[model samples]
Structure formats: C-alpha cells, structure tokens
Target: MKQLPLVYHKKILVLGLAKSGTAAAEILHELGAFVTVNDSKPFEQNENAQYLLSKGMTVICGSHPENLLDEGFSLIVKNPGIPYKNPVIAEAIKRGIPVWTEVELAYRISDAPMIGITGSNGKTTTTTLIFEMLEVGRKQPLIAGNIGTAASAVASKATEENTIVTELSSFQLMGTVELKPKVAVLMNLYEAHLDYHTDFKEYTDAKFNVTKKQDASDWFIYNGEQKNVTDYASKSKARKVPFYVSGKMKEGISADDLYVYWNGEKLFERSIIALRGKHNLENVLAATAAALIFDCSIENIKEVLSTFHGVKHRTQFVREWKNRKFYNDSKATNALATKSALEGFSEQVILIAGGVDRGHSFDELIPHLQNVKALIHYGETTKRLQEFGEKQSIPSVVSVNTLKEAIEEAVKISKEGDIVLLSPACASWDQYESFEIRGDEFIEQVLDLNE
Candidate 1:
C-alpha cells in the first residue's frame, strides 16, 4: 500500500460506524492519525465502536455532540450512508475541513488500478460479471466498494498486478474528489435516490464522478442508448467506449438478436448468455467492454456469461415447486427495476410488490405489467400498488399485511407454468432492515413450502 502522508499525524474524525467507517478508522489509526470514531448507536449496543475504542482511539456513541467539531480535526471520513445534511457534517463543511468517504482513501493507498462501475441499477451484476471474467481470464481482480466488501480494506492488500473491480454507489462517489479508475464503466442513468440526494440532477452528478478524474489514457465505457449518459460521457476526458442494447454502435460494444459484437466484430453468440432481461443485456455489454479493455480473452468472457446465473436478490432464480417457478428480486427497490424484471419474463407473472413509499408514482410500471396475472401488494405502498394492478386489469389483485402473506396469496393464485416473483417496486426499509434480509426471508419461505 502507498503511504498516505496527508492523514499522517493529523486529527481525523471518522463519522458513522458501518463496514466502510470501521475500515477507514482502523486504517487511519494505523497510519498514525489521531482518530475519533463517532456513531449514533449507543456505546453499549455498538460493538464496532467498542472494538475501535479497544484500539486506543477515542470513541463517541449514541449521538452527535453539537460541539464535537471544536476538536480541531483536519479531515472527516464519513460513512457513505450518512448524508451531508447531518448537523456535524454541515458544520465540518462550513469550517472548510475536507470531508470524504473511504473510496478516496482507498484510491490513495492502493498499488493496483481500479475499474469502477456505477449506475441506477445493475451495479452488482455488472461488477460481479467483470470480476468473474477477469478471474477466468487469469487476471488478478479484487472485488470491493459497494458490492459488500470495503474498498479500503481490499486496497491495503492490493498489489500493482491486481485490478480492483469496484462497485460504486452515488453516495460513495459524492464524497470522492480525485478517484480516477483505469477503466470507468457508467452502465446507465435513471431517476433514483432522491431521499439522500437533493434532486435527480444531484444524483446524476454524483454518478458522473466515476469518470470525472480520468485522462485520455484511461477508458470511459458508458451506455450509449441513454441520452443522459451520452451527454455525461461527452464531458469526460477518457477515451469513450459506448455499449448499446438497441441499435448497433460501430466503435464499441453492441448486441443484435444473433450475436454480441465488439467494435463491429462478432465476439460471442447471444445464446451463450444465461442472464435474463434487456437491462441485464445492457449490463453484459458494459461488462464485456471492461473485460476487453483489461485484455480478458473473448473465450473467457463467453465462459463466464454462459454459466453465471445472476447476483443474489436481483432477479435471482429460487426454486421450482408444483410446476411453479420462483424468483427473488427484492433488490427491485424502485419502479424502473420492477419494470426491468417484469420485461424479462414471457410467462405469466404473479408479481409480489409494494414496500416503502418514496412518493414516486407506479404509473411507469403499468405498461410492463401486461403479462402479470396476479398482483400481491404489501407494506406502505400496498393500497397504491393494488390499485395499480386493478387499473391494469390483472386477473387477481390482493393486498396483504406482510411479505409472508403475499407469498401465500401468490402461491394460491399461481398455476403451473407461471412465475411467482418477489420484485418489490419500493425500498424494503419500511418492513425489513434491508433488501437482502427481505430476499432471504422470501427464499426461506419458498424453501419451506417443500415440507
């Protein structure tokens, strides 16, 4: 790992304590920084805070003391989930103290180059695909950032021969200043995450940060079909490589009904891809571009694409029971994601949807619900989604109190050759702690039906 001289002997505030925060705090302390770790969870209940305290770092828990900024800290390394609107962060900003998420620190310390992937959806699948392709091709790739592992932790051990395939989120990118990946992939853009960001523009601006620091020597692979993405690519200094799912693109990656092409040359047959959905096609193309840029062989890319089912919780196939197939798409946290999941199936779908109402309309989902035979709604948007189902003339529409009940109702209504899918069109925060937990529950419940 490279030396981070900027943080050496400096007073640094590590705000919030999750995977990213804990990693950053520990790294900062090891680098000889005077680190203070703060988290909103009470000290007794927060094991992470306790662990850091045991390392001789000062730890504060339960609340953000209004006067905490008076400690003369030179930098604040915050959790990506913690908004800048937090009073402590606002004060730090006002005081001209630099604030950053751990990704910036990861970039500074790593000996390896990074291939950063970010978009509204499909980040996990795309990041996993890149990692798998590189692995099969015998390229040393380390997966990190928003794909479960902490980028800083991965970077500390990364060598110059390794390639860090990082799944970046808008929240993580918003805190980055000079993080330039060797190959930056912008999958696509859509309206999302208005709760954390001020507006759609703010969200898009954050996503653009992935390629903002790249030079002409680096590569910027983006979705050419989305005008917003293309417009963003126009401003990037990197060599532009666009991927298309609709029309053909001569200079980059594009796919037709028969084959997947790379810069006008047929690289692989489309039949070899196991992943479903047009959105996934977009993801596959982007991953292919990144893999090719890294010198991964076309044969290796095809091998990975043919066997890789998908990332968990993002339209993953569960089990088949009584001639009925089940899919867990609890990662469909927005209308667009649900729409994409629906489009993947030609079979009649018994869609189980509804969760935390982010005040976004479900109107965009109506057109795609043509094949939905049954709709089971739950959580905050239960009534709204039920109404949506009825308006779309679905044969069966039921409102349930919970996901378990929704699954029960879907099984009863679903017939042979039908899909029982849990692609909630909203965030899981209103019911489950996270989409992963919600999806796990769905999988467990589905497996229980066997007994």
Candidate 2:
C-alpha cells in the first residue's frame, strides 16, 4: 500500500511519553491532529508532559493509551520503548487502527532514500561508519533513526535526493510494516531484550522484522557465519547478500588478506583496518557491503577504513598502562555480546562483568571464562555469574556497588601483560544513564590511576 501523507484532523494516540513521545506529539499537534499523550510516568514530573500540556496537548499520565482505541484514530505513533505485543498495541490492531513508529510515519513523508542498519551487536558502529562513507562526497547525510535523532526530526526536512542512514532497533522494527530500506544490513543476532519481549523467539521475530518487508528492489545483507541469519534467508523471499569476517562469501563480501569482496567481485582490499576485535571486522564488512551495493567507489570504502574512527562506547581503547590495555565495551549489555567482547583477547584478561539481570542465561558466556584471568564482579548480575563461574571452577573476585570498586579490584589483580576489560554482560540502567555514560565512567576510573 502506498503511504499517504498524514492528515492532521485525525485523532492520534501517542504512547510512552519519553523523548520520542514528546517529539511525536508536538509534530502531530502542530499538524492539526487531536493528540492525547500517555506515559507510565506521572505527567506531573515529566518535563515533556508539562511542556506539551502548556502547549495545549491533552496529556494522559500513568494510563494506557489502549483505552482510546474506540476513539477512531487514523494511526498510532508508538514509542520504540513499548514492545510490539505491548497490551496497547494489540488492542490498537484489533480496533483496525493503523499503528506506526515515528520511523514508519517518517518514512511515509520522507522523499529521501533511507539506508537502514540493524542487528543485536553492531547497529551504531555500522550506522556511524555508513555516515562516514557518505561524506566521501560533498553530501552530508542525515544520520538518524535509533541513533542520533528520531526519524520524524529528519523527515520534517528531507528531500528526494537527500540520503538517510538509520539505525533500527527491534522495537522500531515492530511498528514498521513496509518501511523499506535501499540497503538494510543485519550484522548478527543474539538473544537480547528478552525482558521487554517476554521470550527469545518473540524478541528475534521483532529484530528480523527489519528485513521482513523488503522486496527485490531492497537489498538485505546479513552475517554469513550467523547461522540464524543465513539459515532464515533460505526460507524467506527477501533479496539476500552474505558478508563474512573469517570465511569468504561465494558472491558477497568477505575478508581475506584484509580485503573485502562484492558479488563475485573484489571491491576493496585494505590492510588499514585499525579497529580491534573480530566483531569490529564484521562491522566493517557490513559497512563495506552496503557501500558496494550503493555503488560507492572502492576508494571511498578504502578511505573510510582508515579515516572512520570507531564509535565512543563499544570496545573503545581507553588507556594503556605498563603496556597493558584497558578496553571499555560497556555496550556489551547482554551475555552474547560480552562473550564476543572477551573473545577479542587471546591473553590472560581481567574482566569486570555483570550488571542488572535481564532474564538472559549466564551459561551462554561461560565458554569465555577460559580466557579470563580473573572475574571482578559488580552490580546485581554478579551473583548469577559467580554461581556459573564457581561451578566451572573459574577464578573470580566479588565486588559490588560501583564501577570504581569493580575496576579497583580488577587493577589489583592485573599482571603486567593482563588486559583489564570492562565488558558487562548486562544493562547499565542500574547505575548509569546509558551504556555511553557507563563507558565514560569506566574510562574516567581507568584514567584516574595516573592521579
């Protein structure tokens, strides 16, 4: 179905009432929709709610937006924080009212071609790298979606020739049906966000939705080694392209001698990839695959390989003391991700692991304990991880409360060649505003040894 430009007179239900919620309500209300905002947080303390109310939006605090399903709205603009099976969403679907994320709503109005990147491990790194590749031309791309800014903010000003590189989260994927990407890449998927999703299968279904709506006209790139992505593409009709870091793909991108391939074609070969870790290699492969699909010059991808600095949080090299490195991958907020983070090291490593438990199993990361010199446990996630470590007879030290204490314990136990790795296999919400905040704090504590 061709998407219509949203008309304003329709009644709209904007749910979640967070950062995205406020942006959605303001845009809709200005466009003439009778907007009602709903959030779990009390409207009195929410700054956005107070501001939106002052601007004449009908704010409904601490209530479900599902109550308004009978009001006959044209569409529901859902916040990505709300799960797809979220009670309000199911009710809206039952009522036959179209539901969209700010992304879907933005896509309908955007005249530009969007390039979307998704996966459990490397969305931000790939999205940021894509943006850097585009800067090869004089064109400055709109880097939005699940990254820098909401899609609505970009859509408000997009033109046909403008290019957008969007990072898509699974929650954002759930609300979008036909939001096709010119090039969509899924790096790899692991069990993440099970708490929000109720189960692993449901969470994966949402992540896969990023490519579910694609046709022959859209390009889909996925990890060749990821059995889940490669295996599922055989069962689906979407146009499939595989990328690999260890083994080479027959027709798509692969790494051999620090070079990348395209469909039966060698596009760019480089020895200048400076990012540490195999996961980052996979990330670069995804970025290069999409760039090649877009007909980005081999020279451009080559240039980006060296010039494109990595993102702030993930596996960032914070400091080196006595030639021993300190790596902060605070974004490793799930068991699978932390496992990937640890595998980057071959030598004895002191790992600061654990955070708020998110209903994922600790057994998944147990294999990585072999490389761990010592485990400096922190946050509420420690008890479970310690239990698993003890059962395996892996060496560990227990410390809770703050990252400072965790790092201090790790440093005390570190040998000259041992790496200090802060790769928590859990969320940072228990201690910091975000993974970014947590990473920055880890860097601060690491740098303080010079004091």
> How many clashing residue pairs appear in each of the predictions shown?
0, 0
lDDT by residue for model 2 (108-161), tens: 767788888888888999998888887785345778888859887787677876
How displaced is residue 313 in candidate 2, in Å?
A: 2.8
**The candidate that achieves the highest TM-score relative to the unseen native structure:** 1
TM-score: model 2 vs. ground truth: 0.86
* lDDT score for residue 95 of model 2: 73
lDDT of 2 at 11: 84
lDDT of 2: 0.78
TM-scores of all candidate predictions against the true structure: 0.94, 0.86
Q: Candidate 1 versus the native: TM-score? A: 0.94
Q: What do the candidate models score in CA lDDT, each in turn?
A: 0.93, 0.78
Candidate 2: which pairs clash?
A: none
* Candidate 1 per-residue lDDT over residues 371-414, each given as its tens digit: 99888999999878877788889888899999999999988898
Worst 10 residues of 1 by lDDT: 242-251
Residue 156 error, candidate 2, Å: 1.3
